[model samples]
Structures are given as structure tokens and as C-alpha cells.
Target: MIRFIDLGDQILEGQSEFAWWDTISDSFEEFSGNQTWPNWKCFEEDYLLDEVREMIQDMRPLDRYKSLFPRDWSGTFVSAEDRKKRYEKGICDDIIDEDT
Candidate 1:
């Protein structure tokens, strides 16, 4: 069950940002030959606010500060191919992590 919380005033407006690996490590881009790898998936040109909102629906308490790259991120690092996985499974690691 992929549950997402609202990213509205009750969610995003007051919450901090989240992030992922791709943004922090230079190796992925430097070695992989993909110079522009993103640490966060929120900036994907293919995604819009509505799409992001629809994709992440039942989550709440967005101020967890789960991940970080260049500043905070609106969402986690998700590949285009893994989009469905996130939608279906949600963010397992971050949600389970006690540190964040």
C-alpha cells in the first residue's frame, strides 16, 4: 500500500526538504559519464506539481529531513524507471530510518 501525505499547507508548506544519494556523490556522475545526475527526483523535467502531488498522496509530517543533497529536496531520489516502485512501495528506507 503506497500511502502519501498531502504536500499542501498541512504538509509541504511547513515541512523541511528531503534528499537522496545521487545529489551528494560525485562518483555517480563522474564515473558513470552522466555529469548531470540528480540527487533529488523533484526536479525531473517530466514531472509536474500535480504529478508529484498525485504520486505522493498519503504521507504526512513532511519535516523529517530524511535525505539531503544541495540543500533540501521536495522528494526523494527516484529514477524514472523506479517511479512505479516508489508509488507502490513508497519510501521504505527513509520511512524506516530512525536517524531522519
Candidate 2:
């Protein structure tokens, strides 16, 4: 099971932001790349949050921080396909009124 402790009061909010690669590197600088940042299905086999925390403490980059979404490889909030569907559905009153 993936355990995500809240990015809580103790984490020092807004200290600074680092790139995605930086976070990954910081979290697993000691380990090989393949071992550090693994695919979701394989992540549980070798993931360690303590190392992640230690890396974040001294790292300086956030260009690639991804949210912990289930299928978010890039960690963006929504997939492109989802965005397109919402757009195609439209958001104006005209669309809603037609159905009503």
C-alpha cells in the first residue's frame, strides 16, 4: 500500500521549489536511477519515503513534481484526454438548455 503522509505543518511550507528530476535525484541520489524512480506497478518493490524526505530537505528544484495520481506519470492533475472531453461537452448555458 502507498502511504502518503500529509505535506504537513512540519515540512516548512514554501521553503522553495525544485525541479522534478531534482526531487527524484535527491530522494534517491544514493541509488541507481532505475531503482530510485520506478514505474507505479514496480514502485512498491523498492520505494522508501525516508530517503525521499532526506533528499527534499536539501534539494533545490521543482520543475517536475508530479501529484500522486494513480496514472500520472508526469504527475499532472488531469489527463489530456479528460480535458478534451470536457471541452467537447462545452460549458455554456446553450448546451445545458438544449438538454433541458
Top candidate by TM-score: 2
Q: Highest lDDT among the candidates is held by which one?
A: 2
Q: Write the per-residue lDDT of candidate 1 for residues 1-100, one digit (tens) a residue.
A: 1112222222244343322223333222111222232333443322223344443333411232122233533444344345545555875433322331
List candidate 2 stretches off by more than 4 Å: 1-32, 35-40, 48-82, 90-100
Q: For model 1, what is the C-alpha lDDT against the true structure?
A: 0.31
Question: Which run of 10 residues does model 2 get worst, by summed lDDT?
Answer: 1-10
TM per prediction: 0.17, 0.23
lDDT of each residue in 9-100, candidate 2, tens digit only: 22233221111122433442222234233233333322333446446434522212224423424322333444556667884223222332
**Deviation (Å) of 65 in candidate 1:** 22
